[model samples]
Target: MPLFSNKFCPKKPTPRKVELSVLNKELGPEKALQDLGLEIGPIRLKLGDQESLFDNGEWLPETGPVSGTHKENHKLRQYVQQLEDENNLLKLKYEILLDMLTQTTAESHLQEKQMEQLQKQVLNSSRIPRTKR
Candidate 1:
């Protein structure tokens, strides 16, 4: 009468937890976990009260740029500003190109009218009788 008969139940797989230090080392410290859709918070250990004895002498507390949400917000704001500046520059280029296109179109129409007028003048001159030379 075992709790899990080999035939009835398969063994549950153990869940593996990734350490923040490992992630930081692999992904660089500047990258925010939130960017990858992962939440950041304190790490919890599975051990009981006896785990206190294994604590390391050195404790590195979060501080300065690495400490809070402000850094992430700053990065996001800078990214947005860069995008806005790029958008504005593209818009300016588009306007300049449009103006050039408009000017070219106007010039082309003027040239066509001039050509038509020259053709009409040639036809009129040819139709007029000339003195024999």
Candidate 2:
């Protein structure tokens, strides 16, 4: 009998360690780590002659600051502010619509009551005796 047989082997397959380089190439370092349920760590990147590190979720160049980083940050802040403003505006509009709906519902109920009263008056008038003119 062979040493490695289906029946002789364990039911579950053994877990194997995957190389970080391979994982980076195939699924990117961040996504691979996330899929493996591992804690996120700084990523290292080699661009031409420079080696940069991505730490704290931000890219840090070994040489010097990259252009447009500040501009990007400003744009992001503006976008967040705009979204908040729009959200507040929507909330205000929703409250106004709710108030309008409540008023309309109350007016509708009042109109219905008025119609019922008019119907009752007409019925009562018809039942009363009238003298010939």
Name the best candidate (by lDDT).
Answer: 2
For candidate 2, the lDDT comes to 0.82
Candidate 2, position 28, lDDT: 86
- Tens digit of lDDT per residue, candidate 2, span 14-72? 89986788878999878977898788567888777656778778866654344356557
Give lDDT tens digits, candidate 1, residues 8-108: 66789999986878778878766746556566554433333321112255323334433355557668999999999999999999999999999999999
lDDT values, one for every candidate: 0.72, 0.82
Stretches of model 2 off by over 4 angstroms after superposition: 1-63, 131-133
lDDT of 1 at 131: 97
Full-model lDDT, candidate 1:
0.72
**Clash count, one per candidate:** 0, 0
Worst 10 residues of 2 by lDDT: 62-71
